[model samples]
Target: MIGALASQAPANAGSPAVERGQYLVNIAGCNDCHTPGYFLGKPDMTRYLGGSEVGFELPGLGVFHGPNLTPDKETGLGAWTDAQIVAALQTGKRPDGRELAPIMPWHAFAKLTRQDVDAIVAFLRSVPAVKNKVPGPFGPNETPTGFVMKVVPPAKPK
Candidate 1:
């Protein structure tokens, strides 16, 4: 399975690291939430890994936005070091010391081999830098409060 996953990487034209990273990101479904329009069934490859406005809302936990993974200096990972990237993936802690929401699946990502994680970083670095500033997670103050539930009775047996 790992072999198959790696094979999906792009051709190692300039850097084998970047190719492997692209492949890993694809198989791991990183674009699903990080890349806008992915869930809508059409991803804008031009803005790949540029983050998304549509975020995750986990009620009491808080609302989370997928941050840009591209190398944009102002709004992305351009300022992040390779070690920091690896740390984020393995520990779910951002460079700022804040914890990433569980919706990011950092726990599952922590299981990835070191080489794979490095590849992801390399690939992210190689992409074109997009100046898109993703909003931070909305805390309880900014998020809406309340819950709604509906119950239905069971149908009669035949």
Candidate 2:
């Protein structure tokens, strides 16, 4: 079911498309996982988009800090490609070669239109680049577990 939806939409990187994507990301909980922040007892608003490290303490796995989505050359996705952004949002992957932690909910967003996801990337690119280097979280039992969580295939236009 997910695979069929994954191939339906082709994300186009245009001005309006990007803007729409931004709105979707904002309304949805994309920032909750992709952005760097720790919601321990209290929401870590300071580290917005910064990954969280509380994934291990309570639930099943200990999550890491979300990275800044701004176009900062160093600490953010400034270097990521629009396709990469779409893939990450639609497929769950890092621009480089790493699969984003499962905490980054791509499945739900996968249902969004390609234009909407592109809009999100567009909006993220427009954000002020904040210099913050984020590290990957330790996998469950020291073994990578986000792989199975990467079940998001793509999205189908509603």
| Best candidate (score: lDDT) | 1
In terms of lDDT, the poorest run of 10 residues in model 1 is 143-152
| TM-scores, one per candidate | 0.80, 0.62
Checking candidate 1 for backbone clashes, the offending pairs are: none
Candidate 1 root-mean-square deviation in Å: 6.5
- Residues 1-158, candidate 2, lDDT per residue (tens digit)? 22322221323434576556555655676555544333434444444454444343213554445666767677777787878888888778776678766556778878878767767777777554567665546554554333222323458889
Global Cα lDDT for candidate 1: 0.74
TM-score of 1: 0.80
Flag regions of model 1 displaced more than 4 Å.
Answer: 1-12, 144-158
Q: Give the Å error, residue 130, model 1.
A: 1.1
Clashes of each: 0, 27
C-alpha positional error of residue 147 in candidate 1 after TM-score superposition, expressed in Å: 18
